[model samples]
Each structure stands twice: as structure tokens, then as C-alpha cells.
Target: MSADTDMEALMDMTRDQLHAAATRYYKKRGPTEPDVALIEYGAARAVFKDYGRAPGWFNRLIAPVLLWREASALAALDDLAGVPRLYRRVDARGLLIEHCPATAWPQARAGDIAYQRLDALVTAMHERGVAHGDLRGGGNILVDDQDRPYLVDFVSRIRRGRPWNLPWNWIFGQLAAADRSALAKLRVRHARHLATADDYERHRPSTGFARFARSVGQRIRRGVRFFGARS
Candidate 1:
């Protein structure tokens, strides 16, 4: 075999072993566990140039610093003015927002107000061609001292395309009870449907159904875990 081919094969093997090790480590540590390696692992190997300490091994391996840069660029566009501000790093976990204040989960009249704010935020997100992929409840929505609602956690948002709608019904289930019921109905109606980026482009400029379907799908996917067997 050519030297180039041998080098490529060796690199692939190394990546495979590294991924397996990382996966095992992540599984053992759990989703919330923060690993210092995620930040320094790639840098030590010269795979990364000037990424910050927040670039964990998992983030570097999966999302990569360049992808984050691209997302930053797209998010900076004026069209994304409605998208929430990404302030800075928090606890070596993710970005923090100064405007999105934290509030405890609401109840009764407060709950109703919170949902209204949430609906508006979701609508705004759709209008701007973005979908918060993990907008379940509690963590994603923060209430300020004035009871105003703000959005947090932008890691899993779908900024560029439409996807199958059923999964969002599952996500809606994780939010409020009323939303769960609403999403379940939509999921039942469009259970057989599938969508992609093309569908968004084709359906968005003309009909609103495509956008609605995409939102429903994303919510279902995000909330599905709550309705299934406990993890």
C-alpha cells in the first residue's frame, strides 16, 4: 500500500480507538459530568489551535471549534437579532446570558403567564428560522425578577433546516401538561410524515404548515424521553 494510504489507515484507527475511549468515559461520567480533557485533549495533540478552555474533548471531537465558529457567524447575522444573546461561559458548561434571568418553575397563575411567554418565545424562534432543539422546560426558560421570560441553552437548536415533526411531540410532552396534550395530538395527525431542509425551503415561503410541522416534530423529539421508560 502507498505511504499515504498507510498513514490514512493509521489515523482512522487512532480516531476509532479515541472515540471508543471517550464514549466509555462519558458514559461512566454521566451527561452532567465535566471533564478537563474535553478542553485540553485536542490542543495537546495540535488538532486545535486557539480554542478556549471550554472546548471539552467531546465538544472538540463532535462539534469542533470550527463548527462553533460557524454557528457564531450565522448567529451574528442581523436576521438573527431575535435569537437570544450568548453572553459568556458559565461553570465550564455552556454560555451564560445576562438578560435571561433565572426563575423557579411557576405554579397556577404564574404558570399560565410562563407558558404564554414560552409560546411567544417559540414563535419568535420559528420566525427567525431557528428551533431550540432542547426546549423541554425549567432549564431552558428562565424568569427574571420582573417575571419576564428569557431563553437559555442554544446548543441543540436547529438553525438551518426542517426535520421530521413527530419527534417534537415527544419534546412538548416534557414541557407543560397542556403543551404535552397539544403536541400528542399533532404527533398523532402527522405520525407518518417526514421532512428535511428542502421541505423548509419549499414550504416556508408559501405555506405555514411546513413551519408548524417542523416545530411540532422538534418538540416531540425533545420531550419523548419523559413519556418513555425512565432512564
Candidate 2:
């Protein structure tokens, strides 16, 4: 087949098949972990340099598949509230995410505010026919200048109607030990975001909050994949 024909055939492959092919390609290249590289995203995908850090063994073990899968999943839910913006695929290893420079949070304790926004965002996401497979405290949440919390990762958003094999609390309560104020702020933000329990009730299976979440989740997934890919 001609080169164009070969490329066309590859485009028809399933995500799994493409992944397997990419895996084989990388393994032969003597893969290394990311080098703390900050990806400048604006396309669908981008090649990112991974930062070498401690716990190399662990990251190396799961980085390849996890990174790709996480980013792809988040892309699927880019409409969720707090989910980061996405443009187009730049490459297999990099994504063109909406660039939001580092800005201040809405409230005093940025961490706390971020955590609070995360809580609301997650709740809103759940209501909108999706679940964040991982809502851990550390890297999955960010706060905007207005103290608006954004959920950054979504390597694992499943349809609400689908069956989940993990524990709800384990997945949702990843930041249970984070500062109490942050958590509280998140809860308040969610309640406020929904505009009241009545709003939550009205949107119970598809809340409006997911609109923002979709973007936040995308960014989180992108960052995770970028960090985890090199190994």
C-alpha cells in the first residue's frame, strides 16, 4: 500500500489497536520518563517531555497506557464544568489544551478554595451522566482567581448508567485528608454552583455543572498523561 493508504488504514483502527501499535513503537525506542516539561497545548494532541522524578519505577510501570487512556477519556468529556478546553490532536503524546496561565484563586486559601470547587464540580459531573474515576486531592483539582474550583483529570469518567468496578468513596474521597477548610469550601461551591438542592434535584442525572467540569477534567488528564508518558 502507498504511504497515504497505510495512513488511512491506521486511522480506521480501534483505539486499542492504535494503542498496541504505539506501545510497540515506544518500547523499541528505549523509553524514558518525562523531564518536568510543561506542555504548551492548543491542538488535539501534543508530544510532551516527561519530568524525571522520584518513584521512577512506579510511574514507569503504568505511565504509558494510563497517560494515553486518561487524556483520551477526558477529551470525551470536555463539556464538563471545570474540565479544561481542548482544540485538536497534535500527536500521540501531546494535546492542545486550552491555555490558562497560573492565576489567583477566588478565596484566601487557594488550596482550600480549589478543593471546594472540586467537590462541587465532581458533584455536578456525577449529576451530568459521568463519574470521575479518580477524585484524589493532590493533582486533580485547581482553583481559579475567583476561588472557582476546577476538576482537572478524567482518565476515568464513566457513564452513570454503566457499572463501575471500584469503590465510590475510594474514587471520590481521594482528598478526604486535605484541609478541612478546602473541603468545606468545595462543598459550599457545589451547593452554590447548583444554586440549591432544588437545582441538583432538577438536574439529577445530567446537571448543568458538568459543562465547566468537562474542561477541567481534560486539563487534569492532559497533565497526568504528559507527566506519566516518558517512562
Candidate 3:
């Protein structure tokens, strides 16, 4: 199907239509707050994510907003090559997104070409005013068979308006810098041989906020693992 036609059809689909069209569903492990599944419908596949059943009062309150934020980010970044196409929102709880059959960065042998592509993708995202707040996670960065990078999971994206926007632009700048630093660290870990001295110079030590964010993410991941174990 043509990209435009497929996107149009997806936008028009209802939650019932998505459910009916789904021929197969495989629940996947995800971080805390979201229930994720891979759904196959005819020749197409999509990732279905619902954050309604998250544990704890805090998580329950923030889940919906996070889902919406991700959707908004996807819309703003639709022109990017590696970012997934947003299909449709399923009710207030769920989202159906275009599925890319790619493995996480940690599982793939990310070569120089892959890192270059990833850097370009990140640059593209920043130019469009969206900062993927969690690019440091290996799972959020995927590698295809051709060694191409695909960025996923935008629940923490930060979008800024015009340059004249004061505080927001400043905030966006910091986050964009963080994104670059994260990429530099990733290169240092995965493709150190190809990294330049400037790349090493750009690397900054994680701030308290970054450390706190990582801690919270790790706790959520552990919560998901615990839930899976009990189930």
C-alpha cells in the first residue's frame, strides 16, 4: 500500500476495527505502566500499547498523558525516516503504531554506518523541535538487518515552539544537548574505534537529573519484570 493511503486508512480506523482486523496478538514485555502487544493484521503488523492498567496511583494518573505525548511526538516527527508512523489511537487507553521488525541496539552489531544513520536521525529529530528524552536506553534504539537505526518510544519527548519562545527554547537546548551526549556515550560503548576525539570531548558526565531519570526507569523496568514473574 502507498504510505499516504495506508496512513489515511489507519487514521480512519476505529478501535473496534483494529480489534477485528487483528488476526494475531503477542503480548510483549514493556516497562512499567504500559501493556504492549504486537498485533498482526493481514499483511501489516502494528504495536499496540495501552497504559490504562498501570500500577500505583502516580502511574495511573500519568499514563494517559504520556501516551498522548508519544502520539504528538510521532506526528511532529512523521517526516523522519527511522521513526515509526503513528497509525491511530485506540480509545483513550491505547495506541496502534507502525511496526518495524528490528532488534534492539544491544542485540545488533551496530557498525559505523549504523551509528552514522542514528546520528543523522537524531539530528533530524532535533531540527524538527522534538527531543527524544530517553535515547540513552538501548531498547529505544533499534537496528535493522541492513544496519540501519530506528528510534522508538517517545513517551518523554519534549517539543519546543519558535525560537522566540524564551524558557522553552532554553529548556529544549539543554535536552537536545542531553540527546547528543547520550548518542556520544552510545558510540563510545558500541563503536569506540570509530569515535573521534571531539565525540569524546562532547561527552559529559550525567547530571543528577539524568541519574534520577535512569533510576526511575530502572525501577519501572523491575516492576514490570516482577509483574511478569508473578503472572
lDDT of 3 by residue, 46-139 (tens): 8877664455543444556778888999999998989998888876667988887888898798778888899899999999988877776577
lDDT of 1 by residue, 1-231 (tens): 565563343234333233332312211222222231111122221111112232245434433433353245335432443244443332233222223224433321233354456556556655565545444333445555554655544444445434466565433332223232332332232221433344333332234543344354355434432332223
- Candidate 3 minimal-lDDT segment of 10 residues: 212-221
- Write candidate 2's Cα lDDT for 56-147 as tens digits: 54345554454566466566567775776654343444333443333323333464445546666666665565566444233445566666
Candidate 2, residue 159: lDDT? 46
User: By the TM-score metric, which is better: model 2 or model 3?
Assistant: 3
The C-alpha lDDT values of all candidates are 0.37, 0.43, 0.73
The superposed Cα distance between candidate 2 and the true structure at residue 34, in angstroms, equals: 4.1
Give candidate 1's TM-score: 0.39
Best by TM-score: 3
Record all residue pairs in model 3 with backbone atoms less than 3 Å apart, i.e. clashing.
none
lDDT of model 2, residue 86: 51
Candidate 2 structure lDDT: 0.43
Candidate 1 differs from the real structure by a C-alpha RMSD in angstroms, to one decimal, of: 16.1
C-alpha positional error of residue 177 in candidate 2 after TM-score superposition, expressed in Å:
14
The positional error of residue 192 in candidate 2, measured at the CA in angstroms, is: 18
Ranking by TM-score: 3, 2, 1
